[model samples]
Target: MTIEEQIEKSRTSIFKAVFPNTTNHYDTLFGGTAMQLMDEVAFITATRFSRQKMVTVSSDKIDFTKPIPSGTIVELVGGVKHVGNTSLKVHVDVFIEEMYSSQRESAISGEFTFVAIDEDRNPTTIVSYQ
Candidate 1:
């Protein structure tokens, strides 16, 4: 399914985190760091839906469109974009502050797949959204 398809009718979570002083150098957020945040957001969204812990199985693709500055608000949005027998594909959008304007711009976007696990650490079907 397309990116819009799954999220259009799926559940998700909206998480916000600020860039820490140690999170950036020269006031610019690092791409790797941004991607890690994206993954976490995606996991939170998917696992919350499943009502259990999950592990990332895969990611669709990611692109960095802008730079995030330190001391700015970073908006992390993630949602279920697709679901399978034992997995959920999620989409994440990370936005950075526009500094002076305090506006938000898309900094990075990624899609990841996560599988719910039971107490035994075995893969489990996330049937809530099904």
Candidate 2:
């Protein structure tokens, strides 16, 4: 497959149910929890894109635009945004969905950079099918 096709096929998404245990005092999904989930999704996206062992090196600014209340559903979507020799960036977005309706809105977004590594944990080049 072409590089574009590989990246397109690497797109990953996961759905989660917001529960009271994950909410904060404001009864909304905790920022830290959302971030953890985003990072996980980003990691998956990077791995899927390259089929390599990858580790997150950094995370870009994360913005929370809306609150995700408890008892709701959330969908996290992740995709490869940029590719480099040994590193790549994945963009992740969290969308809040009403359990009883079709209403959905973007609640958070962020970018994470990951570096491909070899068995020795050293940086390795990412092979692309161009």
Best by lDDT: 2
What is the C-alpha lDDT profile of model 2 across 1-130, one tens digit per residue? 9888999999999999999999999999999999999999999999999989999999999999999999999999999999999999999999999999999999999999999999999999998866
lDDT of 2 at 96: 92
What's the residue-level lDDT of 15 in candidate 2?
100
Inter-residue clash pairs, candidate 1: none
Model 1, which residues run further than 4 Å from truth? 1-26, 99-102
- Candidate 2 off by > 4 Å: none
TM-score per prediction, in order, is 0.76, 0.97
Q: Backbone clashes in each candidate structure, one number apiece?
A: 0, 0
